[model samples]
Target chain A: MYERFWRLRGDKTTIIIPGWQSMSYLSDTSNICWFLEAEFAKEVVRLHKVVGNAVTEGRHIVVGTGSSQLILAALYALSSPDAHEPISVVSAAPYYSSYPSMADYQKSGLYKWAGDAESFDKEGPYIELVTSPNNPDGFRRRSMVNRSQGLLIHDLAYYWPQYTPISSPSDHDLTLFTVSKSTGHAGMRIGWALVKDKEVAKKMTKFIELNTIGVSKDSQLRAAKVLKAVSDSCEQENSKNEESFFKYSYKLMAQRWKQLREVVEAGELFTLPQFSPAFCTFFGQEMDPQPAFMWLKCEGDIEDCESFLRGHKVLTRSGKHFGASPKYVRISMLDTDETFIQLIDRLLAIQERE
Target chain B: MYERFWRLRGDKTTIIIPGWQSMSYLSDTSNICWFLEAEFAKEVVRLHKVVGNAVTEGRHIVVGTGSSQLILAALYALSSPDAHEPISVVSAAPYYSSYPSMADYQKSGLYKWAGDAESFDKEGPYIELVTSPNNPDGFRRRSMVNRSQGLLIHDLAYYWPQYTPISSPSDHDLTLFTVSKSTGHAGMRIGWALVKDKEVAKKMTKFIELNTIGVSKDSQLRAAKVLKAVSDSCEQENSKNEESFFKYSYKLMAQRWKQLREVVEAGELFTLPQFSPAFCTFFGQEMDPQPAFMWLKCEGDIEDCESFLRGHKVLTRSGKHFGASPKYVRISMLDTDETFIQLIDRLLAIQERE
Candidate 1:
């Protein structure tokens, strides 16, 4: 998906990690160094502020292997320490699919997975996940539960300008961000949370420490470098053209979404969620639809849309995985150009056959 | 203490991580890639066999963020899935100090910390952690609990030739190893478990997946390179002088132990553990006393060895922290030579004052 952008980046994005870079277990401070580099943390704050997607000031930053790890850490942090019974964890339907497993996998006595927050009428302390520009379906969301006993965790993985308009800086108590979706460096496994409460941040840090003794210093160093490069590119004078990574990514995703929408319209076999043009702060202009995922709902007699796509040699995440109807399928729009082209061709062919 | 070795290594130990390296969450195999790189796993096995320390054949290799993470994973894997109650986790006294916190921090309810296997006379399912060439105090160890219901996980972090004699290949059901202690790359945060049971390996992998997804690819790639370099040096016919990493580490540690012993002998303030000369397969000769930690026992009126050392401007881990007497203090022998020299000077100064 990002081949062209990386081809342009060439050697600038590459980093040499010294064998003895972080040979000692000790970092600057015990808690700080466990999985985070002080420099990397600073860069994360800087990048988020520059993008205007997340509120960094007055927020404690907790780094993780990825947002996936942070998701688990947040759940562990949110759960009551002295509670006799496990708290219920719920998210609305069509949520980020991993929430269920990430919550229940430990079979942790501290928390248990309860379906959709809209129906969660139970009386007790609960954690409700609010994912903005939600996975599977790209829609901005807010927490449905408004109880004093409820805790909210905002997963802002796709809130960056490339994927959505920055309506305002997210000010949730706890919000998750990742370099994978922002800078397209998924392999680095660097994610962070902007936490309002110091106690919660400390507990999350402890969870990370006990879980992995911290994230890899090499990955942290690399993330710092990549994030810096991204910030620099965004701030460049000639950034409007192909030189800026943000502009380049935005253009690619927008173009793909347009082409995909066109093919789906021509086929008339599927319909896409409608997204209106919104003014983006970073771009300083009205932006087109650029969702990370394409939620395609099959029309007519087609059922089990994921299996239907799979039969056409185009693999997609089933809506059932996201606790939705089987008629809907989630296709990744962030894949390589070649993959995108193949997917379009397959969808067009299937449409013709139908 | 290993500064000389690192200085000799210089830039050869550095690795350059490309921005686009291993971007996809997916690996060669879904589970395999999450926990390990096939090549890195192969190198780990090869290096252990070359050093004649761990038996790798017919074993399932599971990688972790660090041996620390694996320690928890092993405990989780060893616990019964169907059991209504949490399993008891026990280790011998003066065990790795992190064992207690690591086991209980999650409050998983899957397992609970039970102190000292020798004193654990419980009649229930239990998991015993046996650290051979144990932490704090270096001594060869075995599982004290011989019951069929008891499961053993051997932590062989210090079983390398530099720390102890590799008398023979260790063939345990579950063995943990790390590049940090063996190659002095603690920052890499890469650890592996050689498991005899496939089911346990799968569970360990699942725990890692649920925890941090998997170990860092960049760290794994770097470890593979370092292990290969270490193995190459060990096999070199001309590595007899000081080129060999193992020989260099052993000689430096052996010399430090000898010098420290002489100073302690003169002071009569503290005493070190005694270990008989043991045959080392790697060196093809009897090895001298070379342990990772100096287990110092204070003599006379020194009530707390740690506090006594602290007064001399030398910091040491208290024996009370390791569930041992306050008269004992554990000092790291793995620091820089300058630090080690300063520690020795302080000890001598305290002795002179006494």
Candidate 2:
């Protein structure tokens, strides 16, 4: 949430972003000056092109903000005046917490949180954000009311083919992606918005410019370099496409999902929602988290959730963050094979003891 | 900027953003990612902590977007808002264009292009921004409005001793620095902010949340590594203090400035007024650019100053951008030593011919 990691002493959490230089959005000329390998340098350029275009279409992506959330706030700002014509932000129940945060951003109390747009009011500047393979619950997506009808900013952060296989290709009016989920490089604050409609994109870009002078050039170039490197890495890994990135991402999540399922089946109490057939859903909380993070909740007590796990060196998000009351916790199926296995083993040991 | 660089066949300007994997926010663990050798990463962090009170004073630094323009925007968002009375943004004219851009983000326009407190209505909730060795004029900062007096964000983007050495230390609430001028990695969007106020820091962090999630994990780590690499490179080259970055930066600017100065020194051919020691200003009637961009006024046979520059194989920003009439023109000081010098050489040659 805060730049907490900067202050904390060394922890086991793996920071996988540094190793991805040549694979991202760096320019070709970048190779000459950077320490990354030539191959990685080329990759940076390749990914950069793909990511940048997603936001800036013709001329410059006019609307600008540090992240997609600012525009979300602006959208709230633009629509808040019409209270009766209520603008609702509808997303899947187990959605990115930030969806509601946007509502808070505008201080628009009018826009109450209604889980996905399917259930919410269908009219107005309703923001329908679908994080492909939703966070906390890794569901690629679900059927939704048409996005063309209103304000739908698809947070495709985890939707990249790297993590989930896209089923029913969604050509929404707007789609958002950030480097954090795709590359495990959450520190770099760069996100791009892809939109078919020019006005929407223009508004978003303009918002950003007004809010935060056009995005940081250094970050943008770095993002561009990383994107190029990743794409190139995926391409070079296999001839046809980004087979490796897709394969690696899918395999990692799939394997972890299996492990989490096994834990749940083993008398471990946790509400596992129906995830999109394409991806995995980790948790279903009974309540909202004020400041607490979500983790897999069980009916019985697992002696210690935080401290004991810390002893095992296994960390999971505390569920208090998602909602008011808390019953279920959340876990991301985003670890390596050994790490996943280790997490499962730790969970099992605790479960048996409980 | 568009993320994709490869897909576009014609002009290769767009680049995609790589995920956090390409950033370097940490210094201890994995380091050394980019092709560019940078010592600025170390200095940036060191100065940020000393100035910001965010970290234990360390010798190393980190990098992000250059100029801290976006960083400033993010900080404004994160810092406390003057909800009672709209926040005020004050900066000297011909200051960094981002001041106004950032000020205009949301709520009330924060960064107004004003000269002093006098320009602003005498009121509260004002953020006085003072750019040291300011952007276009290269003047050392002289304002000392206390932080407790109100909100003050300083743009020490180029306050280093090399370019605009200070005789007496200047004071402010927050200071910003970037690697672009310090290192040659303008492409890497890395900048750091130093603030003494903790509460203000918290608010700035909040604002950052709305923007991009966080700084790039990859870029952060890479910056950590680059800090080491840069220190090594500069040490090898015997680079001294912050001046190492400045020597190169100043050398580049001085050379180009000399060439352009020589031309201006010679003629009734080109007229530049907006440019003090900071930026070079000119006038060519046939140019149109947005307000805040370099302005130009053309008195000679030039109708389209923009076209004339294009014809001369040098790109000059048309004056219309700053919302000024199209009769003016401006040339920024943002180019490599070779490129900028070449541009001046070309212009000087034209003057000689005339």
Candidate 3:
């Protein structure tokens, strides 16, 4: 998908990690190397400013193998060692599916996975995962349980300018971001957390140390390169008409969303979520829907929308996987142009048959 | 130091990882990729055969970020979910210092770190960690506790040809190896486990997946290249005169051990452990002492050998840190040539003054 875009940029986005580089177990300054730490912090701050999604000031940045690892690390850091019982971990319904498995796989006595936040009534310390511009559904959300005793981990994975409007800079105690969704470099597996509390950061660092020693210096170096390229393109003057990464991503996603919605609307047998125009600070104008995923609800006796889509050879994640109704399904809008075209064609053919 | 040797080899040891080489979250295969996994397995088996140290036949190869992560993964896999209580984890005295901390850090309900294996009596089900060519003492060790309920995880980080003689092919159910000690690429942080049981391997795989998704593909690729280079060097008929990694490492370690022994013997204030010359299958001769660390015991009024060494501006890990007596200290024989020379000079000076 983005490979074409990256190819167009050629060596501008290229990174080369040399052998014998970072062979020492210890990083230069801190547990995380000074070069990597500095680059990550600077790029993250710059990206946030350019996108207007998250506030990065006064936050201790801890890097991980990916946001997936950091998610577990954050949970480990938040859970108290002295607690008599295991801390409960919860997220809202229709959440990212991997949350449950990752939290409980270790079967660590420190924390246990309790279901959705709405149903969790346990009287103890808990960590609520808040994924804004949620995975299954493309709606912005907030913590439903407003308790001082609970800690919130804001997983802002899909809150970049390409997926959603930059309504405001999210100010949270602990927030996670990854290069996967932001730059479509998921293979690199570089993710970071912005932690306000030093103690929490320290604990998270320990978790990372125990988990994989630390993130790969090579990956970190590459991530730093990719991030700098993105920031440079955005900051460069007269580059709006140029092939900027975000612009390319936003335009492609918006076009896909529009085409899919048009076909579904014509079908009249299914409906898509309605997202009105929203102000985007980065683009300096109102933007249409450009979600990472398209949430589709089956109408007129289509109980299993995922199965129905599969019948058309268009595979989608069943809504039941997200703790939602079977009538709904989540289709990724971020596939390659060819795949998206095939999806649109299949969807339109279904409408014609109906 | 090995840097001098590496400089001599020049770009032959160089590895360049491209920017977009491995960007997918998943590998080409399962926990590790097909190419890397096959290369690692083949190289590991070949190396073991060359060194005649560990049995690789009928073993399942599991790669990790490092042997450190695999240490915890092994413990997690060995501990049963239905166990009446947390499984006890024990290692012999002068064990790897990080074992206790790594085992109990998560405060996992699955396992608890018990003290040295010699005093472990209350254990119903236990996992005994056996680090052959042990960390501080550098002695080949076996599990003292011969109980049916006790499982063993052999940390073979020091089992390479440079550190110890190839006595026999160790046929342990669970054995851990790392690239750090083997190739002096400690920065790469690649490790592997040779497991005899499929169930245990599956559990370990699950643990890694839940931990960091998996080890870095970039690191894995680099490791494969390094391992292949090592194997190629060792297998070549006339390569003994060439820059073979093991040959170079052995020569450096053997020389360092001899020099350090001479100085300590002249000092008379400290006594080093006496290791008898053993026949090495790899070298096909009775090799001189080449332990990774010099276990120095204070002979006179020096109750704290580590402090005495520190007073002379030589930094060495304290014996107490490895669950040994303060009278003993462990000096690394793997330091840079300059550092080692300075250490020898300091020791000779102290002896001359005394």
Candidate 4:
């Protein structure tokens, strides 16, 4: 497909050739988000002066869109899909929903999920995702778990400054990061992964070149600028009210946890009494128990409850979207304290009216 | 891959997915460039307003990159490649060089130029590019051409107000327009096509979605703005020294052409004895064509000539890049008067030294 692209684009093309592109020796700024080798080197060098030398010390940095969905897509494209050797992707249950879509792009020419690595026959498997400090639970990989083999895509999109100090790299595992959480730039649509290997980096680069033509250059620049600013600000913590940001972030989350706890204590809710993090989930058990969802064990039409919640101007995901039982709905703690309170108050009113 | 992305994305994802996206109602901005069936009605309305009301008379007023390259590629992707059909790609020789590339993308590939429609073995060709009031040379199709089979990609990239006063559309052709020449914003990279077939339009949309993840919204906006500015400027042309700009443009081109014409007329030089009116070329016949690339062609060692041009603070593409005779060269009149003069003087000096 790209061969045709190169042919028609003409030899007048100054930036790229049929099979290779020369490193930009002479800087041309027609595009700010080129993300080509030079732009990558230029940006890393320009930012490293401010980020310090840790960036050069084998940090696995993965970059992508608001969801890390693009990152996953990149991973699939970079892997060996055409080899006669069989390969499959594997992830733990209750994984982020977009994984199937990422894997589907490969489609194995015959099967969906292509026998996810966990289910892959011993003869062949390709990639595995191990979420360290996992989402919805913040559960670190148990130190004794002998998980190995296949490429491991470690997502750490949410493990930014507030979850863990940036000054310390979590030895828990190599991970992904995004500004959506750490810098309140979710609207910015930027994400990156920090991989500890060079071959992985080359493969990822090739995949990205094939997809989306790389991220918006303007967005990347503004994002990199903002990131540097944040890293700088975090470094100069001696300033007045410097530590307050994380404190406020924690306080905001803790307040919502307290509301759910109160509801549980009042017999309006029941914790599955599972081993999970205080921050990762808010659960209540019914006949069908899922450890992560915001369970509403009530006698009512699931659709009707969803409509009722919408009517109250509070929004959340339907459990059905996740292919879960209709009796449950999931409420994430991403909302502000005020919105959370409004939601809780509305829920209490629903019960009172019933 | 996305499963890892989701699993690793830390849990603070408090984003409100746009209700329109969930309901799938709002027009996806990404689909705006390609005309999908779902988007055809909206596009027809838009096409009626922007391109011409005549576009709404049928289902195809498609948009693409600034050079119509998008539509050319689109038609190729939709066509069958291995069919035992008499499918042939027919276009005039000295055609838009990109025409063959477009056909190859479809895999029916480029058939040899059979000169005219009477000889064109057009029983089953998928795509044909018929540029009228053709580019380079302003030769509009003179009506003997047959358009019964095969999709036509009209790269009338240069048929505009300033060039041909009598230009008009053929009865059947997929017409294209580019802002690069029409508005002098090649760098903006915006092109639009009026595809007459709805199914073809729909297929193009799908291919584009796979190709580059939609055109640059920012670049599109800039092109629109510049075009509007040019339009407004045109409205006030009589009072705004409109004649002066044309005179300047012509003067600039003519000055460069004079030096070039004189060199060729001197009999010591050889060039396209007759070439496109849009450009003026000169080749070294007796005067050692130091580097064969006096135009985009170079008789000299390609790499060495490129080095020479770079050292001399000049730049010209080589013919090999254009699928033209290796020693042939092409030059552009798309520069300001000063630059054109500089080029002319430089050429003269090189000639004198030879």
| Candidate maximizing lDDT | 1
Q: What is the TM-score of chain B alone in each candidate?
A: 0.96, 0.63, 0.94, 0.62
Error of 1 at A213 (Å): 1.3
- The lDDT values for all models are 0.84, 0.46, 0.81, 0.43
Off by over 4 Å in 1: A30-35, A237-241, A300-303, B30-35, B237-242, B300-302
| Cα lDDT for residue B221, candidate 1 | 85
Ranking by lDDT: 1, 3, 2, 4
**Candidate 4 Cα outliers beyond 4 Å, as residue runs:** A1-73, A80-91, A102-117, A128-149, A162-215, A232-354, B1-228, B239-354
DockQ of 3: 0.50
Q: Report the TM-score for the A-chain of model 1.
A: 0.96
- Indicate the residue-level lDDT of B140 in model 1: 86
Give the top-scoring candidate (DockQ): 1
What's the count of clashing pairs in each model shown?
9, 168, 3, 37
Order of the predicted models by DockQ, top scorer first: 1, 3, 2, 4
Query: Residues A1-354, candidate 4, lDDT per residue (tens digit)?
Result: 111221332222212111011111112334232342333333433433343322435554444443353444445433564555434555553344455654543223322343333444553445665554444334444222234545556665544423432332344223455545554544335556555665665555444433332443333444555454444443454674453333345444555556665664554422322333332211111111112224443343444444556666657555454334434445655544465677778766654554
Q: Can you list the residue pairs that collide in candidate 3? A: A23-B187, A187-B23, A187-B24
Residue B13 CA displacement from its true place in model 4, Å:
36
**Tens digits of per-residue lDDT for model 2 on B117-208?**
43455545556767665554454555544444456666666554334433333334566666444443334455666555565545554444
